[model samples]
Target: MATGVMWSLCLLVCFLIGAARSESRALQKLDTGGGAENARAPPGPARALSAPSIAHDGRLVACSGKYLLGFEPNGSFAWIVPLGHMCNDSISPVFEGEQVYLVAEDKVIKVTPRNVHTAEPALEVFFSHNTTSGRSEEIIGLAISGSYSSLFLTIRNRGLFTFSLHGELQWSVGPALNLFDYHLGCKRNVSGCYFDSAPVLDQCEGALYISNTEGQLYSLYVDNRGIRWIQDLGSHGKVMTIAPGNSACLYIVFPRKSIVVGIDVSTGSISWTQNIGPISIEKNLPTVDSNGWMSIGSLDGTLYSISPDGDMRKFLAKTANDSVIHVGPILDCSGFSMYVAKTIVEGKLIQTVGDYTYVLAKKPSFILFTLLAPATGTVYWTGEYPGELSNLLSSSDLNDFTIDETVVLTLLSAAKTGISNTTQCYTRRQKIACICRQAKAKFVQADPGEPSYVLLLIFLLVVIVIQAVAILFCCIFWRKKRLQDNGLQKFLEKRRSLHSKRRILGKKILELEQRAAEDASSNEALGQLGEMVKVKEGVERKLYESYSLGRDEPSLEQQGSSLPLYHDKYRSHSFHSSQKESITIFNMLSDTSSSEDGTSSCSDDSESCSGTSSGEMELDESKSAEEAGPSNTANVEEGVQHELEKQHQHCSAP
Candidate 1:
C-alpha cells in the first residue's frame, strides 16, 4: 500500500511537469503574431516637432520658427512664447538661468521666464552706427556674453557694448569697422566688413572674441578695453561659430571649409588648425563639454565626436535634419545621455534622446504616428504594412497595449477621423487596467501596502491556530501510543529514521527544482538573444542590399563604403564619448592588455567586469567595411527608394 501511494505521488509530479512544459511552448507560439483581434483604432493626426533643450530641472525647451516652446520631459507643453519680431533668424534661442535671450537684426532682447505671453520685450539694445542723423541703423550682428549678470552685446557696423541684467548700459568700446578690411580686400567687389556672428565670451579673461564674413577673428580684452589680436584666415568662408574650452579657441567656417582652429585664449595665438570639408560640418556650432571633446553635426546627417587630439572616437549616422542643433549636446554624469533632432524629407520632426529615439512621421492627410525607440532605423519594426502605429497596436493588442498618456491626449485633441474617439476610449480603458495590474503585481511580488499592525495581527492568529492544532494532535497520538505499547521504542526509532530519510529526499528534490528553474531561465534568455541577433542580421542584410543597389558612380560608392559603422555595444555606449574614453583609461591603469581592444575583458572573479547577459553582438569593423564596398549608383538609388516606400507603408497602416 505504501509503495502504491509513492508511485501515485510520483505520477502526479510527472503530470504537473509535462503540463508546465506544454503551457510554456504554447505561450511561445502564441506570442509570434496572434494578438491583433483586440487592437484599438489608430491614433489621430498631429504634426511632430523636436524638443531639443532640457532645462536644469529637466523641462524640454524647443524653437518652432520664431516661437520658443517649453514642454515637460514627456512631451506635454509647458508654455509657448513668440519672439518680438522675426528677421531671418538662423540660430535657436539661448537660455541662461531664469532668463531667455534672443537676437534679431542686430538687436538684443532679454525676457524673464515668467513673461512668456506674446513677444514681450523686457529690454532691447540696438547697434548700427552707419546711419545718418535722421535714419535708424540696422543692427547687423548681435551676441550675448558673460553670465546673466554682465551681458555684452556686439553689433556689425557698431563696435561693442556691455550691459547689466537690468538693461543698464555699462560701457562701450570699438567702432572696430575696418578691422577686416585687409582680409576682405582678397575678393573684388567686396562689401564693407560685417560682424554677423555672435561674439564668444571668455569668462576667465573677461574678454570677447568675434569673427567676420571676411575670415578675420578679433579678440577684445574687456579689462584692457582694446583689441588684443586679429588673425586673418586666408579666403576661408564665413566664420560660423566659436567654441572656447580648455583655454583654446575652436572656429567653425561655412560653405566649403569646416576648419577647427584652436587658439590660445591669453595670447590669441593659433595652437592647431584642422580643416574638414563642408560635408563634415553643419551650420550648427559644435558644443564642447568640460572635457576637451567636441560634438558637431554634419550636412550628411551624421553626428561626430572628435577628441582633443583630433581622433574621431564615435559617430552616429542617419540623423534626420529637422531643426538646427544649436544647443550643444547635453551630458549626464554617466556620459550615456545626449539628444539630437532632425527634420525628415517629409517635413516631419524626429528627435533622439539618449539610447532611445523617436520618429514622429506624417501619415496620409490627417494622421501622425510616433514610432518608439528600438523601432527606428529598422525595417522589421518600422517597415511593416501600414507602418509603425498599426503594426505596434496590432501586435500588442489593445488589451495589454500601453500608450504614453501625453501622446494619447495630444492625438485625441488633434483627431479628425471617427477612429479618433474610439482610440481615445480604448486607451483610457487600457491605462486603467494597466494601473490595476501593476498595483496587483506589486502587491504580490512584495509586502502589501497595508498597515503593519494588521499584518502582525494576522501572523499572530495563524501561529496560534497552528500551535493549538499541533498540541491537540500530540496529546491524542501520545494517548493512543501509550495504550498500544507493542515494542514502542523500536517503532519510534524506525519512524524517526524514515522521517530523516524523507527530509533528505525532500531537500534533494528542492535542489533539483531550483536547478531546473535556473536552466529554464537561461534557456529563455538565450532564445531572446537569438531572436535579437536574427532581427539585427536581417536589418543589416537589407541595408547592405540597399547600398549595393543605390550607387550611380563607382567613386561615390567607394567613398560611401569607406564610411565607419556606428553601433552601441552596451547601454553605456550612449554616454558622451569623452566619459567612455575616460573610463577606459581608468580601467587600463591596472591592466596593460585592456588598451589594445578599447575595452577591459573581465576575469571570472571580477564582478564589475561581468559580461552583459543580453550579449549584444555587432559586426566586426573590418567585416562591415568590406561589406560596405562600392556599389552601382543606380541600383543603390532604387534600393533607397524601395526602402523608403517600405518604411512609409509600415508607418501608415491601421
Candidate 2:
C-alpha cells in the first residue's frame, strides 16, 4: 500500500509539470489572420530583446539577437538577416524608399525587403568605420532623411556623423553629446550615458533633432551648416523622446526633470516649457493628435494629454498591484479620445475612433480585449487576442497603410446588431446609456446660481478690492513712517544741541563760582589790611589834633602864621581823598566786569601795592633808627599809617 501511494504522488507531480509546459507553449503561439473566436497560434522561432518597427512596405521588422527578422501582418516570418554579432539595444532599421538600413556596432548594412522570396537575400555592405573615427564605437541611434538624401548615425562619444544615402561618409563631428563623460578615462556616471533614442527628422527645416545622455538636444542641419544648435536639456535616462508640434515648435521630453521643452525648429529658440510627471519608459513615444493634443504616460499610472500651448488634461489609471506604468501612452485614431482600462491587471488602448474603442488589457489578472465606448470610457465586451500576442502595432503609422472601407463598414454593422443574450444585452444597454447620462448632466441647463458663481465672483472681486486697499494703505503707512523717521532724526539732533549748550553753561557757572571763591579770599585779606591801616591812620589823626590843641595857647600868635601851612595840609588831604574816590570807582567797575578781566588786573595791582607798602615800611624803620627813638618812631608810624591808608584805599576800595 505504501509503494502504490508513492507512485501515485509521483504521477501527479509529472502531470502538473506537463500541464505547465503545455500552457507555456500555448501562450507563445501567434494568431495569424483568423477570426477572433477561431484564431490559432503560428509556429515561429524564439524572440530577443529587439522591438518591432513598421517597414515602408507595411512589414514588421525586428532584431532577434544577431538576426533581423521581418514578419507579415498575419504574424509569420517573412525574411531574416544574419548579423555578424549580437546587435546592441541601439541597433535599429531606418526605412527609405526601396532599401532598409541596419546599423550593427561598427557597420551599417543595406538590404531590400522585396527580395525576401529569393533563395537567399543579398545584403550590401554599405559602410564600415574604424574605432578611432567614432563609427567603430557602439552605435546609439540611426536615422535617414530622404528629402536631403542623407543618413545620420550616432555613436558613443563620436558626435554626429552625416553620410550620403549610399553610405558615403560626408563629414564626422567628434565628442558627440552623451549622458556619460564624453572624454575618455573620465569617471562621472557609472552607468555610462549614450544616445538611447532615435533621431527625429524635421523635413521642413532640413535638420535632424536628437538627444543624448549628457542632457543635450542637438539639431544637425544636413546641409553645409553642420550642427545648428545644442540645447542643454538636463540629463535624461534612456527615454529621451522628441515630438513635433504643428509647424514651428519641436517638443523634447526630459524624464529626469519631468518636463517637456518646445523648441523652434528653424531658429532653435525655446518656445514653451511644461512640467509633466516622472515619465514612463520608452515603450511609446509622445503621440500628437490632429487637434494638437499630446498624450504622455507617467510611471505613476497617469495619462496626460497636453496641448501645443502647454495646457494639460490628466487621468489616472487605477490598479491593484504595482500601478507603475512602464509603457508610455499612445494615441488612438481619434483625436483627443482615449480608451483606458483600470483593474487589477495590465491594459492597453488598442484602437479608438469616434464612439468605438478597443482595449487589449487584462482583467482580474487574466488577458481580455475589451470593446469600450470612447466618450464615457465604459467597457462593452471582453475577449482575448485570439492567440498569445507578444506585441501589438497599429497600422496607422505605417507608410504603406491604407484604410479599407469594407472592414470599417463590417465593424459598424456588427456593432449595430444587438446581442441575443439577455444578460449581455442588458450590460450593453447600460454602457450605451452612460454617455447619454453624462451628456445630459453636462448640457442640461442648471439653475441660474445653483453653484453660486455670481456670489463667488462678487466675493472674489471684494477680496481683490480689499487686497488692493490694504496694499495702498500699506504704501501710505510706509511713506508716513519714513517721513516720521527722518523728522525724528532731526529732532534728536536738535535735542543733542540743546543738551550741549546746557552742559557748556553749567561748566561756565562752575568756573565762575571757583574764581569767585578765590576772589572772595583775596578781598577778605585786603579788607583786613584796610581795616588795620584805617585804624592806625585814625589814631595818628586824633593824636595830631590833641597835640595841636595842647600847643594852641603857645602858638596863638604863631597860629596866624601857620594858617597857610594848615591850608596847604587841608588841600593835600582833599587831593588824597579825590584819588581814593577814583580808586573806588575803578574797583567797583572791575568787580562788575568779567571775572577773567578782573582777576588778571587785580592780581597785578595787589602785588604792586603790597611791594610798595613793604618798601615804605622798610624806609620808615630806617628813619626811626636815625632819629629820637620814641618820637621818631611815632612820627614814622604816623607817616606810614597815612601812606598805607591811602594805598589800602586804592587797592581794597571794592
Candidate topping TM-score: 2
For model 2, the stretches where C-alpha displacement exceeds 4 angstroms are 1-46, 119-121, 132-136, 175-197, 235-239, 282-284, 315-324, 329-654
- Per-residue lDDT tens digits for candidate 1, residues 1-654, read 999999999999987787666544433322342323433422322123332444434454544344455545333445655555653344444556666666544456554655544466533433223455654345543445434365566555554667666677777765343444643221422445555556676553456777765666777776445677766664455545666544244434342454566666656666665654233233355655433456655443455565444555433343334322222333322121223332233344445464223435452222222221111221111122233434433433222223332223222222211231212222322332333343333434544335544767899999999999888866655554422464556545544433433343344334543553365223223222223222333334433332222322222211111122222332111112322321110111223344455434443355554334223324364454344323322333344346555756887998
Report how far off residue 492 is in candidate 1 (Å): 99
Q: What are the TM-scores, per candidate, against the unseen true structure?
A: 0.39, 0.45
lDDT of 1: 0.43
Best by lDDT: 2
> Any runs in candidate 1 off by more than 4 Å, and if so which?
1-53, 62-68, 81-84, 104-107, 115-148, 174-191, 247-255, 280-282, 300-302, 312-314, 317-337, 340-654
Q: Per-residue lDDT of 1-654 in model 2, one digit per residue for the tens?
A: 999999999999987787666444533322121112323322222233354555555556665456666656544456666666555544557788768788766778887766755676657677776787523366667778776788887776565678898667887754343335443311245245455456676554567777666656677776643667776655333346787654456777765556777777667777787776554344435655434456666554566666656666665544423343344332222222332322334544434454233334344343222233332343344333222321232221111122121112112222322122321322222322332333223333333223545666898999999999888865654444323555646544544433433343344334543553466434423322333333334333433332221221222211110000011101100012322331210122243566554442223257674554344434344343334234433543454446545755898988
Flag clash pairs in model 2. Answer: 159-176, 178-214, 179-213, 179-214
